[model samples]
Target: MEVTPRRAGMVALLALLPVLAFGIFRTWWAGAITLINVLIIAVSLYLLMSPTEEEAHEAHADNGVENASDEAL
Candidate 1:
């Protein structure tokens, strides 16, 4: 079965919690570092895993708007 990027990201995020918890238990400094790293990973995952459908839809919508503008003129 193909795992969607979204599912992969969610799994990764869920897995991150235990590691973060460990860091927090060790020291606040470690937790803060872990959090920063986690944030970076999350952002990267978000950007990389964004659905292609949205990009296609936005491109289509832009053309649609242009067509509508032309029609109005």
Candidate 2:
């Protein structure tokens, strides 16, 4: 089985869970911030990694609109 970039990233992230858990256990404030930051990063990565069909269609539509405006100018 071939490992994809996303899968590799997830594995790497899982490896860090113990460290994050330790940090949270040591200091509640810093650990909370770290957890939130990690979650934000994960969500951002998820969004960046996938291109939805609607997004593709919207991109094409935007290009068509731009071309139309350029022709009008």
Candidate 3:
């Protein structure tokens, strides 16, 4: 299944809850867990902010490639 940004954010939130709990409980592994959470949050933010693959670049929108193919044809 494709994970949309919203889905990803939700997943990140779920993953973060345990880290937060560990942080609250002051577990030795809390720091490591929190670091991973940080990475997840960063990736979630990136996915949310950046355009999707389909929208990243206009497909067949660049004239350069089209021009080359047209010449060959």
Best by lDDT: 1
Over 4 Å off, model 2: 1-19, 54-73
Which residue pairs collide in model 1, if any? none
TM-score, one value per model? 0.54, 0.48, 0.44
Cα lDDT computed for each candidate against the true fold: 0.73, 0.67, 0.68
Error of 3 at 53 (Å): 8.0
Can you give the lDDT of residue 49 in candidate 1?
74
Better of 1 and 2 by TM-score: 1
What is the total number of backbone clashes in candidate 1?
0
Which structure is stronger by lDDT: 2 or 3? 3
Best by TM-score: 1
Instruction: Report the C-alpha lDDT of model 3 over 1-73, residue by residue, as the tens digit.
Output: 9766666666666666666777777976765778686777768675776576776566547655556657888
Span of ten consecutive residues with least summed lDDT in model 3: 58-67
Give the alpha carbon lDDT tens digit for every residue of 1-65 in model 2.
85544764575466358658768678877776776777667666656666788977878778434
State the weakest 10-residue window (summed lDDT) of model 1: 60-69
In TM-score terms, candidate 3 sits at 0.44
Kindly report which residue stretches of model 1 are placed more than 4 angstroms away from their true locations once superposed.
52-73
